[model samples]
Structure formats: C-alpha cells, structure tokens
Target: MIKTIIFDFGDVFINLDKHATEKELLKLGLPSITEDLEYINESYETGKITTIDFINYYQKLLPDVSEKKIIDAWNSILKDFPKHRLKFIQKLSENKTYLLILLSNTNELHIDWIKENVPFYNNFKSCFNFFYLSHEINLRKPNHDIFRFVLDNHQLNPVETLFIDDTFVNTNTAQELGINIWNNDPKKEDITNLFTIKSNLF
Candidate 1:
C-alpha cells in the first residue's frame, strides 16, 4: 500500500558528520551558540534570510574566525556521498513504484556548501518528485506541522507513506501522524542495504 517514500538527506543520502560542525563551533570559542544565532539558522532554512547574512551573523559571534574558515568548517559536516547509495536511489526513482520525495530540515549554509562541494547535488535532488527543505518551506522536522504539511500537500495517506530518517525524533513525529517510519543507524545500517524492495523496507 505504500505509495510515497520520504527520504531525509543527511544520513539517508549523503554522509554527514552529525556533530562535526557543532564541535568546530565550540572550538572556535563562542560563549555558546546564542538565541539570535539559532534564529538566524531557522530564518535561513525558511528562506527568510540570505546565506551571507547567516554567515555574517554567526561570524560576529566569533570575531576572530574568518568568514571563509567558518564557511569551510560549517560545510565540513557534509562529508561525502557514497556512490552505491546514489545509484540505489537513482534506481528506485527510475522504477517509479512510489512517489519519491525528499524532506530535510536544512539551512542555507548547508545548501550553499553542497552546491559548491557536491558536483551532482542538483542532479541528485532532481531524482525526487517533491524535494522539500525546511528552510524553503519554513517548516522543520521533528515538528508535527512539517509532517502534516507534507501529508496534506501531497494528499498522501500516511499509512502508505514510508518516511526514512536517521533521526528517531523526526521519524517518531511522522509515526505519530500515522506515517510508516524507519529510523536507521548510519554507522551500522544504510538505506541501500535496508531495502532490497520497498515492500520489505525497515
């Protein structure tokens, strides 16, 4: 009955160091990531703020950290893209067994980072029918509103929509909305190996 598949980009598609950027920030010596900084990040994700503005705002916190260094360090979180996983999603997309969609709670800095670092970023994103980013949509995951937004917008039946994410918190939110969910471990499990067929997906 599954007719739609929602994929989370970080752990689901690309290799990302979950804690790398935050650790780098702490090392850079900010008193802490401030509320204003969090606002800038949220604003960036919703497309309400520009990427440059977000970088500049965060830079002010670390007066000594050059913009270029901050940018590089921020982007370091997105490590690499495994070729086989790309091929798996590509193949799954071609078969058209489900309405393939992608959803991620990502910000402008990350988007710009991927644009410059991942040569095939755009092409790979094109594989999805509706690729939704929290910053663009002004909605983030682990929040029920975003989950509901996707379900309502697509006229999707949650029972038939499988949501896969590395974050149990996000998937759990979707699960509460009646969406089928899979929480996979990036270190121990990969989605490419998770699904030989969507029917038997975890």
Candidate 2:
C-alpha cells in the first residue's frame, strides 16, 4: 500500500511556463542555452552557487541586461497556484491518510518571488509533513541520490512510497528505485484528481 506521497512543486502545484525563461532570455539576446548556462543553472538549483553569483553569471553573458531584468526574465516561468489544488492538499493533510512530502527543485530567486506573490505559500507549506527544496537541501531531482536521500531521511520504504511529478525524467528515476510514480501531464491533469486519476495505484 502507498503510505507516503512525494510531490513536485512546479507545474504540479504552482503553474509554470516551461518555455518562458528560454524565450525571455532569447529576447534579451541570449544566443542559445549553452553548456555553461545549463551547468550554472544546475549548480544554482543544487545550492552550489549563491543568488548573487547566479545573477552575475547571467549579467556577464548579457552585458546589456540589468540585474532586475535578468531576475525578472528568470522568474517569468512561475505562474499562479490554483485555489482548488491548495484546498485538495489541505484536506488531504487534515485527513492524515498518508505522509505528505513536498520535494521541489527550486532556487532562492523563484522562492522569493513566490513568497511575495503567493499569498498562501505558508499555508500550502504547512500541509506537508516534510518539505524539501533542492537549493535548501543541496540536491535536485532526476538524480537518484536525491530520491534515496528522501527515503533514507524519512525512513520510508520505496515500495510504499508514491512519487508524483510533472516531469517524466524525475518520476523515471524514482521508478527505478522501486517507488510507484505518476508522471502527471500538467496540461491535462490536475493534482486535485490524484486519487480519482491514479485510483488503481492508490
């Protein structure tokens, strides 16, 4: 039986324009995403670099873009958190039917934006038994080690844990580690229908 649920934040909870950042950067005269840019992003996501360094790296690349512009473009991906989803999770938390954990590959800048914009961020956070932010935890997903860290730290059995993520890559890694998964398509699926949609698994 699935006794625990691990949820990814972006697209799964807060909506995201997956292509917004790339498009914004391109508009800012970023030629294309380079290997170095990807490395810098991954490093920032994993808390290997500071927010100041992250912004500076981009500023150095797009010399004409101001720090505020760089930050705005980077955060353009984040969208609104729907009220129904918050209610669903809050109800789920109240019932205590399963151990609810939130695991997100997020950085400081995005989080700061959410704190300022999402009025219920704190309420949403309070629903989770454990909240794991990649930058805070020094780990990011699609990496097997991060999944293992969650399991080990929570003393959770992989077989009894269900991982839900909008990204197939992330769910795939957890599946290989023996966790049940739902590779949710944000366009077609809403997490509020979790039990109805993944009824067989539950």
Candidate 3:
C-alpha cells in the first residue's frame, strides 16, 4: 500500500565520499574535527549561515588556505552519479505508479557542483513530483519536524509512504513516525534494485 516514495539524494542517487571533505581539510591544515566545526557544518546544511560566511569561517581557521582551495576541498565529497539510476527514476516517473518525492539534506555548494557536473541533473529533478532540499527549506534530516513537514504538506499517510535513505538515522526517524523505510547501504546496494530488495513493500 505504499503510495508515496521519498528518496534521499546523496549515495542514493549521486555517489558521495563521506570522508573526502574532512581528509581534504586536514591537508589544508585543519587539525581535527572539532565540536565547533560540526556546529558550523550543521548550520550551513540547514541554511542558518550564508555560503560566504561558511567559507570565511574556514579561511579564518586556515589562514594559509585560499578560498578556491577550501571550496575545492569542501566539494571533494561529491562523486560520479550513475546514469542507470537516472533511467530508473525516469522510467518510474513515466509510469506514475507512485507519488515520487525527493527529500535531501544537501547544501548549496554541493548542489551547485551537481548541477555543473551531472549532465542530467535537471531531468532527474523533474522526475520527482516534489523536491525538497534541506538548505532551501531550512530543515535537515534525522529530525522529527522535517519529516512531519513533508507528511503534513503532502497530506500523506505515514503507513502508505516509503522513505529511503542511505543514512540509518534518517530512516530510523521516519520509521518512528510510522513510515516504511529502507536504510540502503550504498556499498552493497543500488537504488535500481529497489523493488527487488524491498519487494514486499511493492
């Protein structure tokens, strides 16, 4: 009875090197991941701070690192987006079998990079009936409010909505709210195998 599908964008669609950014930052003199740094990142992800401010904070921390280098390091987390996934989503969209929704906790810089690097980014976006970006909406995942916002906005039944995310915490939150979930492991699973992997849901 799953009528609406909510998908995460990172790993679930575009490949991401979750550790790449921190590794790259270390190369530019970042000592270690600190509490303040995590706060800043979460703030940026939720649009609590502007991009210019984000870069400036890093510049202040690593005075020797140039703006361009910092930007490059930050964006290093993004990787190749396989076309097969695009085709899968596109085909699903054409069939209109479910109410497709994309709910991602992505920042502006990463999205800009995707638009520039992923040739079919726009087409992929169009496949979704609703596209919600964290920074754009001032909300990030693993939080109850954000999930509620989507459910309320769409008037969707939690039992009839399936949420798929690479992160367990995100899926966990949705499950707590009564939504069906798939906490996909990007290393072993591809979203193209969705129906087979979670066949019972279909």
- lDDT tens digits, residues 1-202, model 3? 8999999999999999999999999999999989999999999999999999999999999998999999999999999999999999999999999999999998989999899999999999999999999999999999999999999999999999999999989999999999999999999999999999999998
Total colliding residue pairs, candidate 1: 2
Better of 1 and 2 by lDDT: 2
Cα-based TM-score, every candidate: 0.91, 0.98, 0.99
> Residue 43 error for model 3, in Å?
0.6
> Which residue ranges in model 1 land beyond 4 Å of their true spot?
34-36, 196-202
How well does candidate 2 match the true structure in TM-score terms?
0.98
**Per-candidate count of clashing residue pairs (backbone under 3 Å):** 2, 0, 0
lDDT per residue, candidate 2, 1-202, as tens digits? 8999999999999999989999999999999999989999999999999999999999989999899999999999999999999999999999999999999999999999999999999999999999999999999999999999999999999989999999989999999999999999999999999999999977
Candidates ranked, most accurate by lDDT first: 3, 2, 1
Give the Cα error of residue 7 in candidate 1, in Å.
0.3
Residue clash pairs of candidate 2: none
- lDDT by residue for model 1 (1-202), tens: 7889899999877889978887888888867767777777667777788887878787778889998888777777898888788788888889988899999988877887888878888778978999998888888888899999989998999998999998989988999999998887888888887565344643
- Sorted on TM-score, highest at the top, how do the candidates line up? 3, 2, 1
Weakest 10 consecutive residues of candidate 1 by summed lDDT: 193-202
